[model samples]
Structure formats: structure tokens, C-alpha cells
Target: MSNHARELAGIIMNRFDAFYRRFLDITLGAKVRFESKDWLGVQLAGRQRIRLYDHHVNETLQAVRDHMGGAPLGQEGLKALKQAFNDRLTEHANPEIAESFYNSVYRRSLRHHNIRAENLYVHGFIRRATDPDLTPYCWQYRTNTGALGDCLRQVLERLQLAVPFSDLTRDLGYVDRYLQDHGPAELRGGEIGLTFVNTLFYRNKGAYLIGRLEQGGLQWPFILPILHDDQGGLNLDTLILSKDDASILFGFARAYFMVWCPVPALLVHFLRSLLPNKADYELYTAIGCQKHGKTEFHRDFLNHLHQSRDQFELAPGIKGMVMSVFTLPSFDVVFKVIKDRFTPPKEVNHETVKAKYRLVKQHDRVGRMADTLEFTNFELPLHRISPMLLAELQQVAPSLLSIKGDTLVIRHLYSERRMTPLNIYLEHATDEAVQDAIDEYANAIKQLAAANIFPGDMLFKNFGVTRHGRVIFYDYDEIAYMTECHFRDIPKARYPEDELSAEPWYSVGPSDIFPEEFATFLLSSPRIREAFKQQHNDLFTAGYWRQLQQNIEAGCFVDVFPYRRRQRFRFLYQQGNDKPGDGASPP
Candidate 1:
């Protein structure tokens, strides 16, 4: 490879490497140790790694499916799996779909062989093909017969041409040679586990990021923290798999591609122009300021608002999580800055950033989120911020945002509502307050779900009571749509091993959601819990979620009125015909 190519390759690799550690921490609950470039140590201390028999890719698939409680190619599972794949294909073709696709792929690979779908696999042959003779070697994994090759054919049918098994094999050999001379074998303690591959030839389509974690199975089942991006801001939008049934394959096919291809030729001209000037920051600017091409009036107002609030001070909100609310002495609009780093980037947690943006943008439409100012960054030079406000923010939301060096900047969310957190109000309870709280909470949940949104964490702190006494969800980090979540009944642990194990016996897919836990999680005290049970106990069952999901899927809109049931018109809501209560109230 030429010097230009090598440099471009390094730049490409660096972009992917940025999120590698964070991905491991969030997805696999593991850590990474960079011993050297070649040998990376993925510490598996904080996770569950089950062992598998040698060369049992199919069995591992069954085990993984069982762990996630997914039926193995059962009618429903097959439908869901196919939908998942087709979802990606559609997203690639067009971006108008409302449902944000998070493609998470898992690989249960073998030697030179790579398996993508249950029936889709990739294989490599050692000898290069010339002219028209692209025959596979006998050593090739199950070629021209059975499920493996048939699977590869399925994938090949989708691509332009069948990639020769030898092209990959020849390039992989180049990587091995490079590593033999300049490798981290010694520093890795020969423990990076590269001695054998189930297959010798495996190639993957789509973008490759770094290995995020190490799940220590008897043998590795794909690489943990393996992230795939199919053009969604380099987010972990898709999970790609490389499964093979072969032996003596090295660490990664991507590594070899980088070593051999180097510049990729095409990107060099583009990358070179940026080299003379520090154009990388232009890319960083693109990421950080994605919502704005250049600063508009409103955006500039938000990005530079701190400068104007000189003598006027604001007090931080008390007793809450997920947001740092500051009270304006003017006492109207409170500043709600998403404490910097309050949520992981979408690359790790799929739609967190998108969810937040949705909540703010749709606040009025959903009749929820306190009318918000544009989501922007708060920039307060270290010298400008008041000591009292800083100390208060630190006390209430220590992790909300932070000050680095001489500057403090964080994602800001300014809202016009001067509402108290419902949890705080509940601390000094009243019958009226309790009734309103219960009614508003239920109303918000139903309305949001009706709008296809689910606040994944339904904690009291996440909800607020507007001065007019309506409860609305303010926190959006864990928010997701009702359609995306797969509500399920918890699977009972059958085996003693499963019961005793800390990790779940059943498989936990990324979208698997258990509505059964909501009752205990949302309703706090016994009184509040019983109150919720009296009104909305159905929330604790899978049936309710399933029906609601079905209803939404069937093009039904279940509108939830914002007013309390007690306050509704007598005709709109009556408690067992008990004189239907008060005034000309309407829901």
C-alpha cells in the first residue's frame, strides 16, 4: 500500500475506534485494554460468557435464541427476523420510514466461514481463482453442498457478483504476514485468542467499527461489541455478522482489508485535501452541530444565551434525575439542560438522541414536554458561571453535565413551564394532589403510547406536574416507541443453573420489553401503588401492551385526554353512577 493509502486507512479506522470503548461498556458491560494496535485485550470480568462445544455454530445460535426467549425459526420468530432484515434493506433504499431501525446483528462464526443470517454464510478458499475457473478447494467449508453454501448463495444472489473465495484468502494471508513481523503477540500474552478460526475465508458487507467487548465463551461467538453502521451517522444502526465453518482464521477480515487496501484509492483524493488544513474539526463540527448548518437566530440565541444572564441568576431544581433544571429569577421559563453526557450517544443506545429530539419537537403535539426552546449547547466560560448555581447543579445532578478545564458546555433544554416535579409534590401529599397525580400520570402514559411513544423508564422524577396540575413526561433519554418494544411475559427459570445465575436465563433481545415490571417500577408507596392498581392495574400485564401494540399496528388511534378523570364531564366519566360528580368538566 502507498503512504497516502495507509494514512487514509488510519483516518477511517480512527473514526470507528472512537466509540469502541463506550460501546463495550453499554452493550456487553465489559471493558477494553489496548495493549498495542494488533492485540487488544477485551476484559470479560463484568459479564456473562457461556461456553460452547467446538464448531457448534448452529447450536450456539439455538442457545442464543433460547437465551433471548425467542422461538427458533418459529412462525413468529421467522417473521420478526425477516422483518428485521428487510427493515434494513428499506432504510438503505429510502429514509422516509417513521420507525427508526436499529440493526443489531449477532455472529456465531466458525473457521474461514462466516454466518450472517441463520441460512446466510460466507466461505473462503485458499487458492486464488484465475480466468473462469473459480472452483473451490476441497478444504473449503462445505461448498457446493448443504446449508452453508446454500446460505452463501442466498447472500450472493443479493450482491452484484459472487466474491471469489481466494480474493479474501489471499488478503487474509497478507494480514498474517504483517502481524508476524509487527504484532502484539508478546504484549497480548498470547491470550488474544487468534490461533484458530472455524473458517479461513470470511468477508462482510457494510461498515466495520472496533470490537466493543469480550464475551468469554468456551470459544468466541462472534466478537462482542461488534458494531455495524449502514450510513446512519456512523451510529450502530446495524449489527453485521461474519459466520464461517472453518479453522485457523485470524482476528478480523477488516484488519486485513486495512493492511492490504490501505488508501482505498478512491478516498485518498478526498482525504488529501483535508490534510493540508485541519479539516477533521470540520467533520467534528458536522457531528456536534448537526442540527444547524450555520447558526440561525434562535439557535444562536440558545448557543449564546448564557452571556446575557449576567446579574439575573437561576436556581437549580431539587429532587430529580436525568435533567438539570435551573429556576430563572424572572420565574417563567426554566432552563432544562440535558446534563452533558446524561445519555449515551445513539451509537451505543440506538435512539436516545433521536428520542430526545422527538420529545422536544413533539412536546406540544403529544401535549406533554413543557414547551421547549431549541435543543442547543450551553457554553459558560469557567469565570462566568455563578458559584451557587454550579454547586447546586453538582449536588442535584452530579452527572448531568460537567465543567472541563476553563469552560463548561452542555446540551441545553429550555422549557417555558414552571412546574414542580410530581415526586416532590407527592412528598407533601394531598387527596386532590394524589388524585390528579394518578389521573395525569395514567393519561400521559396512555397518550404517549397512543402516539407510539414509551418512556422506557417510568420513574416519578421523569414526570412533572404543570402548575395547572397536568402531569407530563419531561425526561426522554430512555424513551422509545411502543411499536419498537416487544412486550413479553417473563420466562421462568427452569434449570437450577438459570435460577441461580445473575444473568437472565432467557435471551434478552435489544427490543424485548417486559410490561409486567412497570407496576412495581412506576407506583412508589403502598398508597400510591394501590391507587395505581385501582385505576390502571392492566398496565402490569403483557395483554394490555400487546393489545395496544396491535391497535396501533392496525391503524387505530387511541386518544388520551389530558384532563383528570375526576375533572372530566359527568357524562365523559362516571364512578359507578355515583351522581357523576362536579361541574361542566370535559376531558
Candidate 2:
């Protein structure tokens, strides 16, 4: 390799290492933020950390340009550069991440339009699953060697949290009861041992201690949510023993976690072991590597095309006026393109739609809004798209799509995890299921509100139900911040003529919102109306929204537990104080 290529590689690696250290520095503050109750600082740190990748990428690109003395790299030069880069990764801890960083620099600096294997790392060099040197980043505990409670105690102590556990013995009893009641036979028989990731994951008010219990063939994942009490002590909020619960905690709807990961690839690998069904992109994004997650997702998508025969069709839901959505039957994601013109009653423009999505990306999702991956000039095979879907896209968003021989190119679009539209799910669901979904839908609205988001369109069609039966809002074209909205009540008509008018008698501002009118459209079905009113009648009142806005404006951070309230340890064992040895038995 030429000295320029090797020197460029060295400079890139140095920049990446600096970026990684800064990332870790921000993550390291999570514990101190939690200890000192700096909720606002935590939120700011999350937003700032998200922008670091792009900042470092731009910096690295400049450094590479200066090193090349403004000379463009030809095909041979690019190959030499790539090879030199690969050689530098022989025994590196985060080879895949560094490759992703290099790809960003190559693409942005070179103004690269096409994805070429020679110039960029379209496919990762590291085979993570089979890599022998992927060091173990977790602590192992053999339960059969000692009592389970003792092992749990040791695991808690390993975290070395700034605040002490308020009642370790009581929390242990709670964990024991959960294991006895919910665990598989292996857990009760002392056959399963625990393997905890060495780092604690911090998000919002919670610091999660995540691990998996396995004994030969049987494996069960768990997450222990550690929360700080108002006092200078910590408490075990809950014991999450189910894979479903663990997945929810790491769901796409939630904000990214801040965890110390020396080798992010190793951490992602460890998480994938616990969550075999979770995609590599999701695992990376969960651990705060969203830029790399985008790279992984592109690779996964390309691989899926080779492995499946399914064609892309219109996503199964009511058509979105501002966006056209399509999905491949065999794939778990949907691609959305902004329409050339929105339909009536949808007043948002293209830029407005993009701004709303960006707001969702920057704001705390609060586990109620699905995250989207934005892409530019994305391509798909024309033959793979169904005729109807293609026609629909042409009619709705022709300006966004173009054809180059067999390929259909989208100038800009977003890809998101597909879920069953809540309206569609409710239509086919049983009575009991409908009731459960209604409750969940209401909770989703409340949670989004508490996070300062107002889903401007609260219809069932705007929301989707994940496979885990959780309701998450996906349509972002009409979303607004709760603080920006003016919650209002419908005023009484001043005259009989006013009551008969087609439009509202009261003058409304652009930001004015009548909460009472939400029910007129959302609760049209009698069963849904009854069920929604049973648990969330307050949601229909202006006061409910106004109070939330007030709290948000006052800088109050609401606690929205990922798990069910019934699963909370404090709720489960309410009889005793945090003082241990209070003679409290498991309820």
C-alpha cells in the first residue's frame, strides 16, 4: 500500500478512537446524572451524543482530504486505501464500527452516489458470530455452586452503583418469588446460571442490569431495572424474567440506552445471544450506535433480497395521505416515501413532514413512537415491486421515484419496522382483545403526552400494534409537541344557527386543539367507545392535556415504566419499608 493510503488509514483510525472515547465519556456521565437526579442533563446528553457520529465523520473527512492534498483517489488508489484500512483492523476491538466510520468518510468526501464494494465497506469484513477473538464482555454466575439469592447479591454488587440498594435482602426475596412463580423448570432446579453484561444500561430514570440465565439447552433473558428513590438510595424497580419483556425494554419505540461498551460489536453480539430474534441493526441502535445500525440494516436488506422471492406490495393499512408506504411480504420493514401532494384535510407539506419525523427522532420516544431510518436515493428492483404498489407510488409520489433500467430509485425515504395497524388489528380482534387494545392505545397516547408529544391525529389508523401486543404511534406527519399545542374545550353554541353550522362556531388558531372532539372520530365504535371510556375518559378532556403540558413546561420528567405496573417490586411488596430484615416474605 502507498504511504498516503496507510497514512490516511492511520488518521481515520485515530479519529474513530477519539470519537469512541468521547462517546464513552458521555456514557460515563449517565451514572453521575442518575446519582444526582440530573434528569434534564440526561436528556440533553442523549441528544448531544446522537449528533457526535456525524460531527466526527465530517472531521475525519476533512483530515483525509488534507492528507490527500486535495487529490482525488482513482479506482486503484481507493482499493489501496481499503486494503490498508482492512490491514489496520487485524486485531481491533471494534473493526466493524471503524469500517462504518470509514464508509461515511468515503461517501461524503468523494460524493459517491453508488454503493460499490471496492470503494466502501458495503459488506462488513468482520464475521461476528464466528470470530474467535470476540472477547467475552459479561460476568458469569454458576447458580448450582451456591444459593440463587447469594448469586443475585453478588451480581448487584458488581454494578458498583453510586447509590446503595435500599433493601438488598427484600429485593432478593422478590426476585426469588418471581423465579418460583414464573421461571421454567431449569431455574427452580438450580440448573440455570446467569451471565450478566459487565456494563449497566442507562435511559431516563432507570439503570438496567441485563443478563441471561442459561443451563446447557435452556436460556432465559432478564433485566433488573434499578431506580433511585427520592432519598439517597436505589431500589430494584422490577425483575423482568421474560424474553418478551426484555425485548420491550429494548424496543425500537424507546430512546437509545447509554452503556459503556469498549467493543460495541462484542456488546451487540452478547445482546444478540440473549435476543436471537433481534436484528443486528436493532441491537446496535439499542446500544447507541445508530449510524452503524443504518449500515447493518442496508446489508441486511440486500441479503434479504437474495434470500426471498416475495415482491413489494402496498402496506396493509389505510393509505397515508402524506406518504406512500410499501412492504415486501417476507420482510419485517416498510419503506415510506413522501407524496408529491397530500390529500385534503392533510395540510402538511413535504418539508413539514420531514420536520415532524426529525422531531420524533430527536425527542424522547417514550416507547410509544416507532423510530425510522432515513435514506437518500435508495434503490429497489423494479420487478420486485407489485404493479399495484408501483402505480400507487407513481400516483402519490411520482416526483420521489425514478427508473434506471430494472431499478426503481427513491430520492428520499424512510424505512421503519412494520407492525399491524391498530385499526386493522381491532377489526379482527376478539371482544377481550379489543378491550385490551383500547386500553393500550389510550396508554400510548398518555405516555406520548407525558413525553411532550401530541399525536395531532389520534385515530386508530395512525397507530400500530407490535408483535408483542404493544401499541405504538408510527405516522409522524401530524405530530406536535404538547407544549406547542393549545388544548381547548368546545364552547357552547351561542345560538341555534351556530349549532347547525358545518364548521366550528368558535374561532380556532393554528395551534388550538379541541380535546373533546377526539372522541367524535376515535370512539365511533360502541364497543371501543365503552372500553376507552372505562379506563381513560380523562383523555377526552382538555384538562388532561393541559395538565400534561404544564408538567412538561415545568420540567417534570414523568416515569413511564416499560413493564406493567403490577410487576413493580414496590407495588408487589408494599407492606414493609426499605430497611432489610423486616421479616417480609415474598407475596
- The top-ranked prediction according to TM-score is 2
Candidate 1 segments whose C-alpha is farther than 4 A from its true place: 1-323, 343-351, 359-364, 375-384, 391-413, 495-501, 562-587
Q: Report backbone clashes per prediction.
A: 35, 0
Error of 1 at 253 (Å): 50
TM-score, per-candidate, Cα-based: 0.40, 0.94
Per-residue lDDT for 1-587 in model 2, tens only?
79988988899999999999999999999989988889999999999898899899999988888887888778888889889999988778789889889988888876646556668888888776554443367888776623778888888887787789778888888887777776665554645678888778999888999988887777888778988775578888888878788889999999999998878887876787677889999999988999899999999999999999989999998988888888998999989999998899888888899989988887889899999999877889999999999999888888888898999989899999999999999999988999889988988898888888889888899899999999999999888888899999999999999989999899999999998888889889988988886768888899988988888888988888888777787766676644321110121
lDDT of 1 at 384: 57
- Candidate 1 lDDT, tens digit per residue, 1-587? 23332332233233222322232232222111211111111212211111111112344344445544663334444335434433333433111110111111122212212223332211111112233211221111222112322433333233222222223233233323333443332222222321111111111111122111111322221211111122221111111122120100111100111111111121212222223221221221111111111122233334445446552234433533445566545334456654433433323232455456544443223455443434333445666567877775666556435576886655445544456677777778786668667766776777677657777778777677754566767666677778899989989879878868877778889898887777656765876876676567777788877888887787663323222223222222224644432111222
Q: Which structure among the candidates has the greatest lDDT?
A: 2
RMSD of 2: 3.9
Model 2 CA lDDT for position 550: 86
Model 2 lowest lDDT segment of ten: 578-587
| Residue pairs in clash, model 2 | none
